[model samples]
Target: MTVFAMLGSTQAMYEWAEKNQTVFYTQILSRLMPAPQRDDPDVQVNQVNISHLTNLEAATRIAFALRLGMQAKQELEERREDLL
Candidate 1:
């Protein structure tokens, strides 16, 4: 049950991420840029590069986190059933 809940939450998070990828990347770039006007040509160029790199990093991190969580949940279920 707990495992299912975790899986559901993970799925939901992934879905949300997928649905808002553009927004998420935009926000990330916005944060990376200096304050005030982020529309400067130089800032825009840097933001574009940073956004691409950060997007890849974010994807990798999410995948790694999900894999770890799934493994931990599976282990917990196995232990629970063994004690049952």
Candidate 2:
């Protein structure tokens, strides 16, 4: 139960971090691009691209978290088994 709670908390923190990172990236991109009308197809495509990039960035971060979590869990189990 504690492990599950820890996992949930870790994921929640990761989500918050991901959201902040996306906001930072979006701000940077917005500064680089000129403002355009909402009806403009080019502007819409750029917005979609930004969304895709943000998702990709978040996925990369989550993947790293999962890998680290798995590695830590494995090491803990190994140590426990050794102690027993």
Candidate 3:
């Protein structure tokens, strides 16, 4: 429960942080979730490989946000194992 809460809160924070920003999670997730399309011929591959969100501070914050969610998941899994 606690783990879920932390993950939920962190995820919510990320969403909230992006509410006013042009770059949202969907933009990044789309690139990562379906895997890179470097091999595919459909999408136009850019010569310069760079992410939209190129700010260092923003990048670190995003990393921390994801790390928190992962920690939460680990905590929940541990709890589940204990319950069983």
**lDDT of each structure?**
0.75, 0.74, 0.71
What value does the lDDT take at residue 29 in candidate 1?
52
TM-score versus the correct structure, for each prediction: 0.36, 0.36, 0.36
Per residue, candidate 3 scores C-alpha lDDT tens digits across 12-77 of: 757765784544455654555776546757777545333654688667867887999999999999
Error of 3 at 34 (Å): 33
Query: Where does candidate 3 stray beyond 4 Å?
Result: 1-54
Residue 28 error, candidate 3, Å: 41
Candidate 2 structure, TM-score to reference: 0.36
How high is the lDDT of residue 49 in model 3?
35
Model 1 has an lDDT value of 0.75
Q: Over the stretch 11-56, how does candidate 2's per-residue lDDT look in tens digits? A: 8656765878787467755776887856755553322243556777
Model 1, span 4-79: residue lDDT tens: 5877776875677688988866875578778785465655342224355677787886788799999999999999
**RMSD to the hidden true structure, all candidates:** 21.0, 22.1, 23.1
Q: Provide the clashing-pair count of each candidate structure.
A: 0, 0, 0
Clashing pairs in 3: none
